[model samples]
Target chain A: MEFYPKLKASIEEIFATMIFLDLTAAEPLAAGTEDLGCHVSAMIGLSGDFNALLGIHCPAKVGLAIGSAMLGMELEEIDDDTKDALGEISNMLAGGIKESFAGENVNLLLALPTTISGKSYKINTPSGSQRVIFPCEIEAGRFYIDFKYSPR
Target chain B: MGKTVLIVDDSNTMRKIVSRALRQAGIDFSEILEASDGQEALDVLAKNKVDIVLSDINMPNMTGLEFLKAKAENAAIKDIPVVMISTETGADIIDQAKALGAKGAVKKPFTPDLINETLGPLL
Candidate 1:
């Protein structure tokens, strides 16, 4: 199934209603350029019908912007609140994706979300895995919603 | 007298957002309590008098479904109303939640009006 549109709609709805931010969807990033200079990332694992990892990657400024907007407080730096905010967003995005799939009769279970942040880091998926990184632009900057899944 | 509501979710960000959304929804509450997981929610319920519960189904320590089952088993808190606010609002899960005593559900990325609509009648 083509998940890009489903994921994109989820992103739009989340930003519109919860974060109170307007965003535009960019073209899906090419495979080789998965890195978007992201300083922070939040990920959650999925199981059941398929095994997958869903993540939201953001640069520092964009992360702060999203976190601040989500919590209705200004976030000066990447802290627990920022991580938690992104993680919850990841969780919500995954849920949206799951709901989309459920419409097609796919079942999925979600794991608790986790965050990764620093000056530098890399995420490597297993060989033969499929992945898509959807870029989204808000006022502060661009962020990516990444979905990697094992071929069913 | 004003009502007290417990917001249960692992994410501090979500708890804050739910609280803010409740205010935006124009729901008045004397105090709002928080818990990161079902166990913590149980602990809070034991210690405080919460009029309602808004919970997330996917969580660590104890999931919302497990929490519902546990809450059903407990005589003291069994009758308190719980409305799920989560992304896990699939028919099977929601049906299970309802069977376990969840009053209703509000999906993630919800608006203030949606929150008010789902939770207003119960209050």
Candidate 2:
């Protein structure tokens, strides 16, 4: 299935609606070890017929921008609620897609979102075992959404 | 020139923003009702003659999509325009909503002007 187009549309929708921002996709980076810096990563595990991971990565600035959009809060510094909002957004996006594929082969694992610093971490999935990432820039902050799937 | 609009969502923060924006859009009505979820919305829709519905797509017991679907199945409820509000931007989701017979859709973290612009003509 034309997955890239689907992913592109989904990511763009999330950004456009969530924070009232426009998102254009950047090049897919070859796996690199750059410190991803201060960002929020939302991970949703796809189980059942589709064994994979859908992850959203955003810098502190993007996270704060989202928070600003929802809570009307101006966040200069990241806080627990800020991180929670990012995680909720990923869950919502994932849930939206899951609803689309309802009764299909895929199942969702209700994973809690974790906040972390640095860009050194990696997603260990059944698929090729690297970040197949797409760069996204919003409100002066740059981020990425990475996807990978694994076999049972 | 006037019609009732029901705004449904769980968050007070979001509800306030939506109400303010609706008012800003010049959507003055004799009645404006608010519901927190599908079941709550059902209650409001039971007797009230609402012309338009603005709902958050994601909520605890019932979601906007589900509400839309259920409303579609009911003859009395189907005609009322349901506009989904959320942070979700999936194309498939939008298509699904349109297919389910949504009159319109708006994304979250809304600006008064944007909300008014998207909803005004549609309503």
Candidate 3:
């Protein structure tokens, strides 16, 4: 099965269900290009049947709002808790995608999401030379997930 | 009756959320303990008395699998119920968690009600 369309569907489902948004993009970022908006990064490793990296990058303000909603407190600073929450969120989104790939004989190994803060950054991976830039817009701010895939 | 809880996860955010959820659920617990990863969790088992363990699968230093391996050998830790919470979609990992003696599993973005429902009577 092709990964991109399934991935896109998965992203739409995850965001709609969890964050209450419908994510749309001008186009899927090329395999590996370091061009993304402000967001949280959650990456998981795929191995066994499938080997690749999946991540979710949410705009900073959106991330904060999500964190704030979870914490039951206003998030003024992007501290340890906020970063961890976003990482976990990214992890969940990847997990959501994995379910769609079942029966493909592919497997997965998810890692703890490494939280990155800032208005922008570049993601380079060993698997895919080009980073797929994800630009997300929300009420608070904009962010995107940088996705890369490598088959074993 | 207050039960004993063993909270497991590397993230302070998640751990605290689990703890707060437990409290929010009105599931009074006699004691609560923290373990950073599976290794520390095993070490923790050596000293503390806990009823249910809520764990996260991935971590630095020691992933959740490492803890399960240790649990298989340790006669005592093996019996304690483990619940995994992660955004990890891999079925193998979930199977591993069960094979390692986890009682049940709950995904991330879990509500307090879900926690109560999953661990309610036993916890």
Cα lDDT tens digits, model 1, B38-115, are 999999999999999999998889999999999999999999999999989999999999999999999998999999
CAPRI quality of model 3:
acceptable
A1-152: candidate 2 lDDT, tens digit per residue: 22455566666765665456676887666654555564567676666556666777777777778767755567676676666566655665565555445535444443333455454454332334434667777766877777675557
Ranking 2 against 3 by DockQ, winner: 3
Docking quality of model 2: it rates as incorrect
* Cα lDDT tens digits for candidate 1, A1-152: 68799989888899999998989999776545344688999999998888899989899999999999999999999999999999989998999989999889888988889998987545544444488877798989988888888855
Candidates 2 and 3 compared: the better one by TM-score is 3
Least accurate stretch of 10 residues (summed lDDT) in model 3 chain A?
A124-133
Q: Once superposed on the true structure, which residue ranges of model 2 sit more than 4 Å away at CA?
A: A1-5, A13-24, A32-34, A45-49, A69-73, A76-127, B1-4, B10-34, B43-51, B56-58, B65-123
Q: Which numbered prediction scores highest in lDDT against the true structure?
A: 1
**Stretches of model 1 off by over 4 angstroms after superposition:** A121-129
**Best-to-worst lDDT order:** 1, 3, 2
After the best TM-score superposition of candidate 3, give how far the Cα of residue B37 lies from its true spot, in angstroms.
0.6
For model 2, how does the per-residue alpha-carbon lDDT over B6-122 read when each residue is reduced to its tens digit? 999866546655776777667666677899898789879988999888887767788778888888888988888888887544566788888988777776545567777777776
Give the per-residue lDDT of model 3 (tens digit) for A1-152. 46666666666665554444545644655454465555455566656565667666765677788677656678877777788777766666677666666656555655556776666755544444534545655566666665666556
